[model samples]
Target chain A: MTALASLTNHQVRLAQRLVGAPTRDNWSFTTEPVQEPAEGGVLVKTLALSLDPAMRGWMNEGKSYIPPVGIGEVMRAGGIGRVVASKNPAFAVGDTVSGGLGVQEYLLIPQDQINRNGLFRIDLRAGSLTQWLNVLGMPGMTGYFGLMDVGQPKPGETVVISGAAGAVGQTVGQIARIKGCRVVGIAGGQAKCDWVVKELGFDACIDYKAGDVKAGLKEHCPKGVDVYFDNVGGEILDAVLARLARGARIIICGAISQYNNTTPVQGPKNYLSLLVNRARMEGIVVFDYADRYPVAVAEMAGYLKDGRMKSREDVVAGGVAAFPEALAKLFTGENFGKLVLQVASE
Target chain B: MTALASLTNHQVRLAQRLVGAPTRDNWSFTTEPVQEPAEGGVLVKTLALSLDPAMRGWMNEGKSYIPPVGIGEVMRAGGIGRVVASKNPAFAVGDTVSGGLGVQEYLLIPQDQINRNGLFRIDLRAGSLTQWLNVLGMPGMTGYFGLMDVGQPKPGETVVISGAAGAVGQTVGQIARIKGCRVVGIAGGQAKCDWVVKELGFDACIDYKAGDVKAGLKEHCPKGVDVYFDNVGGEILDAVLARLARGARIIICGAISQYNNTTPVQGPKNYLSLLVNRARMEGIVVFDYADRYPVAVAEMAGYLKDGRMKSREDVVAGGVAAFPEALAKLFTGENFGKLVLQVASE
Candidate 1:
């Protein structure tokens, strides 16, 4: 219980807004003395932080699904943590939890702001600390609701997912398969593609870095794509739009490819395909499904246990300072799966 | 009864595929001797033809909702006509009809290919022949189904329409107002704007040629747009996307703004707003509602008669020889409303 003067919480703060791909220069590493929780408050030690493609969005200055991280502020993030001290009756010391822990070693959630910070006890019995930050976290919730709600895939329908090796894509592809869909994934590089197909059991995976996604879709989804879970926007989205079957549904989860663009984001030139095919494109933000997170967690936990689903995370060490370099991996397509920064041990 | 001997048919054919905006050089005029209908067939003489923005897409060279107009082929079109000869028990000579008449003086529907041409008898009692080509025709069908089926507008909800003075836009806006929604329109000029707001009963109309559409939307649709029936896409689509309410639905009917573009069609840069708002964008094709056209037509025809809806048409004279110049008026925004070409006087 080092939520006191004895503890120094190291943190990464946004130093400047991004122009394109984020660099270490965009962040400032600092350390601050930790303080004990106030009455009705709880303090948690960050175990791991989720490094996501969406983090790239939070670094920019503009209106988005969530407010951008202000300069000189702690970079916002979500992670698994262990309660080190608690004055709240609801949260006992040593309770494992998941919430917005930021890119820091400790999270001091004030009493009035507990719910706002999304502080909640997470059961490690269903998943490990890192897995809690992966398949059972924000990314998982996004994939679950975005697919099942918007996509509404029918059995025997061909479901295509881009960024197949990434956090959200892995969850979406696996779940679409569980729902009786024929799953095809698109990822950069042959290794990621091979893993998504051979390991994750995707029916096919297109190596976008090596081949034309349009031709790959035509070959893999001969009957045309019934559901498309888009992560990478730009050309990949256009490719899927071209292959959409009549009544197809496209879920707009993230646009990792266009996040770093110095120029305006390339809008899907083939969006007219939506009209031609009588298809739909919809966007989803995971927070809207917060009320039912536990339900999704319960369903996914069963799949994880039965080996019907797999949660793969690429854990990066060096704690909070590693965040800037780690997040850059998302845009470069370097990380193989769910990228998590390990801040502390249980 | 001039189906055989003393009659000649003047026709307009596609001389070349279009690269951008169409010109007279892309069209070739020809004349041929009229031929009688075969067994179980019908022959119709074109009266008034519906000029549409979608015609631009039909002239392109590639896969689309329909096959592209082939080089040297009679240009595809839909128009109101008078049946001159009928061997089918279902049709009679002198019967008023509507179907795919092409850009020609006669539509000769053969046996077993009647339905493929979408040929059907029209009641002059419900509407005039020119009105049939405007509000009761393909554009009307597109607007009705695209707005009601895809937009799903509710009472008091704000519904915005682009290309407000055009064929589909007028139908959508008038119908939206009649259905108890607050209607905002976007058109190119002052006269069209004034007509759309005052004559068509739209709550407001933005003269895009005169002012900023984005600012107009903000002021007019203060509550945000719940349903948007988009005819002119590109930047206008982006403007509406930026002003979308949470859970908004956008009906993608046409992209007249980008139809003649030589460059890649602009994808809405503000499309990410869909994610922020949890909105959906979908496409609609009137042909998909062929079976339901009668239902929509009957309802709209009531609106037309009861004074709840009005159909405005910008009619052009010159028979079939004037199609090239007439259609160009659409892209130039010179046509104030539903543009129609008079192929033959009643």
Candidate 2:
């Protein structure tokens, strides 16, 4: 394929509305010849696309941090790309960049949408292309702010993380450990639990699928859970709620476990423990901390540089056609870390 | 009565564990005379008592912010009284103050249990005896901080209070209105609705039993609800959840509706709207703002004195015998404002 094909050609559009969980039938891939960029617009060739649990929330028809990806519209995704062509004064051909460029080999987006207050730019050496969408990106920022700002970990405090082996949960436990907290991670299996305690330096790890979570928490958090960073909100969150100490804080970064739920989401049965313990539980979106991204990025990158922080990416290589299956991996817990789609070759 | 008689006074004990909603038979009141006070104890004559919804949660055998009142123990109630006699240097005979002396007419309590921090002297001019148990007491403090600190209302923003015209709800709406918010109230009937809107100056009031709350909200708050100070939980709270503006906040001060629920408390079905609209629903206990009590009391009192803030107390006269019936008023929405029991005559 010519560079022009990579720049302004292949695309995927929402073929139909999803009935329940998304499937391959919901998307349709197509190809078009290169098109010239209009003034104030730049053409981007997507290289890597981030697959987040939030993608499920985005596909459904409802309100969220943003509106759903419309039927017959290019399926929306965040990606790293190269500016293969440009008519915007701020950008030129061949500048590496990132933005919500859709599931397409090429995109011509307006400068303002592309800029978004300078959140996206070309930075090849800042981190790996996949890393930019992982630890140095949304999941990293989610962990840093959700823990440091919302959870407010203090040294010697017990920090518990549900979905402990997943991308955001893994980073949350590590950050809690770095903050001098005694981190306890709750994942779904022995392997995930072992990785959390052995590789992530968590003081304890509970395999929630194998054992009774409430009992596990009782044995592990003898002092009680002071800060609970929750990613999977279901029975595990309920278990954590029961273990909260007086004045504990629960930071809800995401609730992946119940995302594809057909009916209304069910909350922890023991939430009133907040009143009984004089504790606080807050739901957070990472965009709320946008102004503090530079601070988080610098701190997280330092840990990565020093080998104190590690990130794993399950990269699926294909064109835009791989989006649906890769997104499903998050809910199944099949993606051990950040999931990304390699959309095009440089 | 002799000191020995007062010290061994008959105490109301939990007769049996409540299976679901508590009944009068669940409590048994027995009387005995007091014994002599310890070296640093005071003999108190319980003059006024505060019945709080939290007392219901405390009655259940479970862990909470404070411990359960315990089986066969005096039921926990905050009372204002005179130190009829004292052996403690910090208190003198006839000193008027408030203490957690349980639901008894007289008691010999160690000074540390009541006066560990310092004696909280009541200002007779603040209103009257029962007002201390209402407007200038726990419920008052709860309303003040939950709105200002937790709800964080902004001028002209819509503030909707559930259980409006109840103790905490009435104060929250009034305070939010005073803070320049366009206030809306949710209550059980037209009378309460009229009282809140016409007398209390709330922009509008919805009687949950009389109308569709969601439709009423859409009609009243064109801009959407910015602060929902929830005292009543369940469906009313769920209705409010659907109409939240972006960045709206739900301050969970109390859930009186769910306190007696036999099944586990069901979370608001629409809570996912918090993530969608970038809003937050948080649980807050008023005691967390203890350090700011003087600040709240001073402002509320000034409002009370200047005819800006209204303190409506629904007082039922009698001694400890009135406690059970008075507590029921909160659940029935029978009492218009703060529910207080007169434990003794002046």
TM-score of chain B of each: 0.98, 0.94
Q: Identify the runs in model 2 with alpha carbons over 4 angstroms from their true place.
A: A1-8, A87-89, A110-113, A116-119, B1-11, B34-40, B86-95, B110-119, B288-292
Score each candidate by Cα lDDT: 0.91, 0.80
True contacts kept of 2: 0.42
Candidate 2 - CAPRI tier? medium
Give each prediction's DockQ, rounded to 2 decimals.
0.84, 0.49
Off by over 4 Å in 1: A1-3, B2-4
* The best candidate in terms of TM-score: 1
- For A196-266, candidate 2 gives per-residue lDDT tens digits of 88887999999988989999999999989999988888888888888888878888777887887877788
Candidate 2's TM-score reads: 0.92
